[model samples]
Target chain A: MSAINGQSTNGSTAAPGTPRTGGEVVCDAMLAAGVDVIFGMPGGASLPFYDSLYHYQDRIRHVLIRHEQAAGFAANGYARATGKVGVATSTSGPGATNMVTCMANDIMDSVGVVYITGQVARPAIGSDAFQEADVTGISIPITKHSYLVMDVDDLPRVMSEAFHLASTGRPGPVHVDIPKDVFLETTTETAPDQVNLRGYRPSKVGNARMVRKAAEVINAAERPIIMAGHGIDISGAADELMQLATRGSIPVVSTLHGVGTFPETHPLSFGMLGMHGLAYANFSMRQTDCIIGLGTRFDDRAVGKEDEFGPGAKVVHIDIDPAEIGKVLETDVPIVGDLKLTLQKLLPLIESRDRTPWLDQMNGWRRDHPSLKIPDSPDSVLPQEVVRAIYDISGGEARVIADVGQNQMWASQHFWYERPRMFFSAGGLGPMGYALPAAMGVKLADEKQDVWCVTGDGGLLINIQEFNTLAAEGINVKVAVLNNAHLGMIRQWQEFFYEGRYMGAFLDNPDFAKVAQAFGLHGVGTSSRDEMHEAIAMAHEYDGPVVLDLHVDRVENVYPMIVPGTGVNSVIEDPR
Target chain B: MNGTETHTLVATVADHPGVLTRVASLFRRRGFNIASLAVGHSEEPGYSRMTIAVEGSAEEVKQCEKQLYKLVEVVSVRNLTGAPAVTRELAMIKVRVTSNERPGLAEITDIFRGEIVDVSKTSMIVQMTGAQSKIDRFLDVITEYPIEEISRTGVIAIARDDVGPRNGRARG
Candidate 1:
């Protein structure tokens, strides 16, 4: 009904009298939405979209990843690093299915990512054509929203809505599946200037009365702890979090994803709190009288044995999503709004108080339960020592993207993060093989920022093909493989809970450093404490992508672990 | 039936493809049991209204309401569990009867204000529309005879009087 490709009414710039294909319209919509980069791998079903991408290379940079899974993770990492909406595209069937895990991962971690999948032709959608899959139905429970566009005219609006839903509210993944025919169909549809969804509206401002009630609860309590979560970093509320903690004199403990939100180096900042979290942090949670949960979901990992966690403590929960307010823990004051805005409304009402006795008691616990100490070994290298070596070699300046399992725990424990967005991990879904590809995304987000991918022997092999991507793209991300020749976390659990059977946990492995060199990148291998520091330093100083495989003690276990179905008070420390 | 109260919820959602699947999938994934659900076009253009009866405790039902709102296609959801509302269901019963039994069946159908829609040598179809309890009672009374087939529509409900909009628009 609108003019046909004239001076664009939407933000897209299309020359007058020029015809546009559906693929070009989709690309133009992304441009109008301010997406400068996309991580994707094209296939037969998405060839038309890739063809359009070829022409827009100057405006939109496309990173061709090795696998669709890496594309999804790279997009997720891009979103987490820059707080922008990340975009990934793949073909139908296996390519789209490969992205399911990452979509689940993004939803669990509350990262904003838009996944575009190409479907079969419209007529073949349900006929079981080659490469045809019901991706929209499969992603219904995982994605915040999804669309299968049959009509070419709806492409622009669907693209705009997908980006809007992915980047707003709780910030999760949104999927868009386009038939191959629609990508080649000719259309003059223009992207909308704004989204017009009647059912979708995200709440941003906190209720004034609820803020006052929370302030009252915090002021009257003697020992109050601020349980900060990933929402702090997602909403950019780190400064406000610091203000509230300092003003109220509350000890701040972080969830795994909330690692750097409150600056672990700060005096009031206790370390990460979870199953593998520090003992002092968990002890503070147990002893506190009032718990102020800020931008967190009170996950089962963070709040072990919910009924027993923070017993007799009055709780105040603030989050953007209303469902998360009372989902797990009961709250005395529940404020549903954006975290930064809610904290702004709360800071003025908070009465400045110094609980010297509470701070002194927490300091006493920290002294008595010293964790994260790297054991001195003359001939053997410990995993904790490798983490500490990276931190020392990089001078605590690199952004550490850690993979799952024991290596993730050691990295979180040993690395001291002083700024927000410095520590990234698969906290919620706990997906393995996330570090390398996600590091590619983080480095691409800001080429000058030093990025490190800390993974284990088992996790690295999952996405080892990504090493070629790094070398080809010339992304200088340092890789540290804490090679213990086993799935350390699984083996630890097997030993602790399964009578040390070690079924399927041992990894008969390859030389990872040589694997890196074969991919045309620098490689170094170290097996002793003496070679650990030098290998890490070499990787850090290398101008190109480099891998440092540090062989550590095979049987070392992560300490301060709270056994499953138990409370933080029952944390098990290293007996020695 | 297990002594847990059933909460009736009315939701207005966009009339789009896969909307029903989204709503049903959410209930199943969230571990909520759906006792009954009926959906049809609403008075508003491009929107559909759904009446869902869910079996859960008061807390679980409240969570169900919150979770349903999380779906982007769902415009609004109202829990009409204890609200003043009118509920009804429709049922068609086909009973096997001989010529001798027709009179007795007709007399009973008249008392319940039901109509015999069709009749053959061996069977008679009776159509009944009323509250769920009345329909249940009718089925109970007719089960003594040889019944060939039965079909019943799930419950559909709306707020009574001017309590709320039938199309689920929020009151200004």
Candidate 2:
């Protein structure tokens, strides 16, 4: 067959009228690879991939999101929900640049996602080809691996490799950049084989000696606390975490990103630690003799200054990434591997010992903080009250996807999640519009579970376009938008640190309820605490997407603020 | 050629774009000119790597390896100094020379058992394969002439078929 453009589009015999080209092969390969949906916003370079999507309409669903950035988040949600590889497609330049944040989110959270973007034709490559950006180069820091497929023959292999890499080990996003010509080229090579990445391999288990050392510390310690992080959930090690916690009778104090690793209702579980963390959880961590740190990056927020974060505690950090061991607080022992596997091994070696004094102390702190109390401030609805309602209705057992800002803080402090990984939030990136799409990812990851996308009004507006993606894909995700007219979290910071300099913070948003209705999903508006429970219950029962626009106190702050640089003692204690 | 040493390293990364740049930057910034470095596809598409290499010496390379792991993308690092291992490097050298320099090139090539890939009126590009020493020796001899450009395939090696890194021993 002759090469045309670079795709193998000419050799296949066409019926009397139907013309088969290189585009068809790619579409066929994409279908064969089990890609049902692709989220993207199109442009000139990606016309060929779009052309292929046109050919395979029913087989592959292409969702045209409002922005390319949202496309990446939507795909991430799809991947998180389905356990299948999430795929996002976009054209070059800004379309590709918009994907960086989402890609970084996947890298940080370890979500399996495959990103495809069209590059300018090979001939136009280095000339700063119109709309041509070095996507492969730009994404290297955030992807597992990336490929710039210059030749059409390399597409199948590159794509196969991209998907393979994205789905394995610590699942993450990978990019495959195809030039315009390559997307349209004709090729002679057969369908590409699953390229074996010879150098890539993830160690399934931790070093035995390290695991044994971790166990020794835990077993010997008079009071051991398990500080869980996002790694535990990303690795699907929740079961192992629970097993270890149960077997060892160890108490757990989770970081904000670490919530949902263990059920909040569990007797030993103290939800979230830090400035805003429950007084009991922070106190528990401070007093513990040994800290079994798993899957949690001891970000400064989790542990105020390294010295006082967990003072007097010997931290045995068990993380997949070894550098995190002593990067902050010195680690007495470091176990590197899948959190579940390491915990599974250490579970057997640990001895059950009750830390009655420690538990009593933690209980006392819990009593002191007593969670947040939502005072009726004028007509402003409290976000904390809504979370308590959801917990009351669902018993806090279902999965909760808390969007950024006050909604995230409220969900983190209020919603009681018993399992890890279920509480998905944009922790490292702290992207404002992360919750809804991530909630969609979480819901799709486990459909049977009740998934609530707890978001704020400002953040919800950023990716509200994905409501179309969610509705069209038939994903049952519940969205609770804490409709405070301002960007709650940033507003809080501005109120405290920046001296109330709003500056693009307060967001005048659309009627989110109507927006949901427009997308053919259920939409509800809540202004009172009494009505919040019934609304959440109604939304949860609906078999499709639903949005609850909650009117919350515009100035309500996530309290117990720990001024940065100051140790734990500097925490603002006035509840007023 | 001067005496050479080898060191192994491991790093944990955020598994994002430009991580390779961060990895490559370590060598460039530290001024530990990397003789060769190769990154393999990772098992957890976005995790860490047991990156093994041989450069500098036991002490210098070890120090460099530790710093490499400290880079932001780098999660952690370890140097297998006295551990069982294997090492290899791939290089493609295109040397420049006149007709008169052919014999010297050939004589030197013959000593190293190298192959001539291309021959032109002014220069002949010789391809050599071996440890860092063999390639270094060929380049050192050819440096006397107008050396146009040199392209080297960075080093990629697995421990000599024995114990598989650190994880293998744990299974036994």
Candidate 3:
């Protein structure tokens, strides 16, 4: 099959003069859109779609996940990792509702995904039929666009539009809800050759005047820093970002999602910035004269106490979404265009300058602060060390997907990502139990790449049922459960903000290794630092899935923290 | 008008299902309060024009405009806040009035260029069409009598002459 405009041409499933089922039309559409895999589960409403899947299994590989939420996260993980439109599906009502959190996560993180949900029959849609839910209505706020297909003939166009909208500028999740009967209805329609949405044209080229203004700002700045964000990865502008940074001798600070866009090993890299970010990186915000915010929204987490953040710095905000510019902070030069194109235009005009004094100043701060220290403890292993050990063993090559909360911070802080899409986490929504299932998608996306799921005891248990799926599918993803036996982040907050009154922060965790073993996967439990490295190695060596549960210190908190509602200047380093 | 806390914005959008909900939801989610919103079919066959009066700072309203443009159904948005735009509202007030008091009420309606659309033995319904402020004044003048109910089709607006249609193009 030849490819044109990134879509495969082998889209027709029905022979000439033969009618095609709506489900087959959907299959043809997916093939046309170049969808090679889908993460989903079967249900009553989606039986016909599954029946069609049975026929098209040769072209599209379907992974039957344990839960709809896992299916959505897995699809999201696939999208984040590959920069393609990941697909997930489910039946009506409960199945559709289960995917809402993942949709929210995808939207928040700007991930491109297409969620195909089966609905009640068209006639029974408004009658409150059994297993029916208003999927499109529920998804309106969370998705980039949503459609409730009433006509079976519109399937091809809707599928094409869904993929187009999902993967376009400022990528986000697009949903298509189809009636159960519609999927079974016969049609001769084929996938559309083009998608024409009059109201949905995204800007690609930067305005020449604004790009010039931004270039002028960059050229004039004596001490400037590049705040690279998820947009860099989304637009595939990492090379452009590096060129701009290197040309101007500018320091680079990454938002959590922006990690790995610029190689952390580079001297210009200042590491992740925000709450739970590097102290030196957060501190650098105060002294910088210009903030070249590329593809970042300057989220509240990234810019703490917005009014007090970068009080004197001139902000040059460049984003594909016009709404994101000047939405959070006042931007001096707001460039609304694709980051890659805008940077290309801005680079040549940016005059080269040596910022040795600024670099030396940040280096001094890095020396003094020195975050990511592994505490020495004989009785319990530190989760930070576990992440460090994974980075060391994998040689910083594994795609590390971290579950939310304390474990997420530990992974972001310790593991140095050298390439884009190497580190995946629930950055915007902060959903727990994302790693295990997301890792499944990442590993499936690229079988040669080693994948690791670093999760906390609290987060791991949320989607622990996926161990059965892993065992059944034989996905070789290594898992590291940081078992603190508490909702570590909540506990840390309770100790600091709530005056030590722990309310529902403690958890009596089960033996995760035993749980994995019961699911027919390799499992190992390690409580001491001595056993941690060997256990990680054992999990890495296992051909199939393996869960290595590391019992870390119960009270250890992620530090270099900015107190909630505080500014970047007021950073609280590890007291110990 | 540019400095005013409340601004009026006009958006041209596709006349598609749930588009109104999407627009209303964007306002609610973005924390921008909508003072009034009037939507109807535009000169274009399949598109609708929405006149939205929102309350916020200039920057906040600008952000609201940008967010509205983010909607796939919304083709374009024009902030008619400081522009020379023709704006009007239609209001119907059903008031409790005696046969004797009806004469005075009729006079008040006539003074405001409004008409008594309906009249009963002890009640009268006045239909008024004008600027929001004119309708507010008419309501205040009629408040001397016992009030019954009020129905308002919120403000709808369009740019005046010489200001070309900034309807379809997205502003940076």
Quantify all predictions' global Cα lDDT against the true fold: 0.89, 0.73, 0.89
Write one digit per residue (lDDT tens) for candidate 2, span A1-576: 111112232222233234334466556555655667777888998998788788779777776776788778877877765667888888998889989999988877777888888888889988997798988778866677677777776565556666666765567888888888887876655443344444444456799998888888888888789988877767788888888888878898888867877877888888788867776676676678898888876888778866666688888988776545666777889777777777777888988777778778778877777656666565767778778777777777667777776778788888777765556777767787887766765665567888888888888887788888778877788888888888887888888999888887878778888889999888898787667777888886788888899887778888766777765655675366
Give the residue spans of candidate 1 off by over 4 A. A1-11, A15-18, B1-3, B162-172
Residue A64 displacement (Å), model 3: 0.8
Instruction: Give the per-residue lDDT digits (tens) of candidate 2, residues B60-99.
Output: 6655765564343455565654565454455666667778
Model 3 vs truth, CA RMSD: 3.5
Which 10 residues in a row give candidate 1 chain A its minimum summed lDDT?
A: A1-10
iRMSD (1 decimal) for each model = 0.7, 7.2, 0.6
Candidate 1 lDDT over A93-160, as tens digits, reads 88999999999999999999989999998988889999888999999999999999999888877887
For candidate 2, the TM-score of chain A alone versus the native chain A is 0.88
By summed lDDT, the worst window of 10 consecutive residues in model 2 chain A runs over A1-10
TM-score of chain A of each: 0.97, 0.88, 0.97
DockQ by candidate, in order: 0.78, 0.07, 0.75
Pitting candidate 1 against candidate 3, the one with the higher DockQ is 1
**Model 3 misses residue A460 by how many Å?**
0.5
Per-residue lDDT value at A386 in model 3: 93
lDDT of 3 by residue, A69-125 (tens): 999999998888888889999999999999999999999999999999999888898
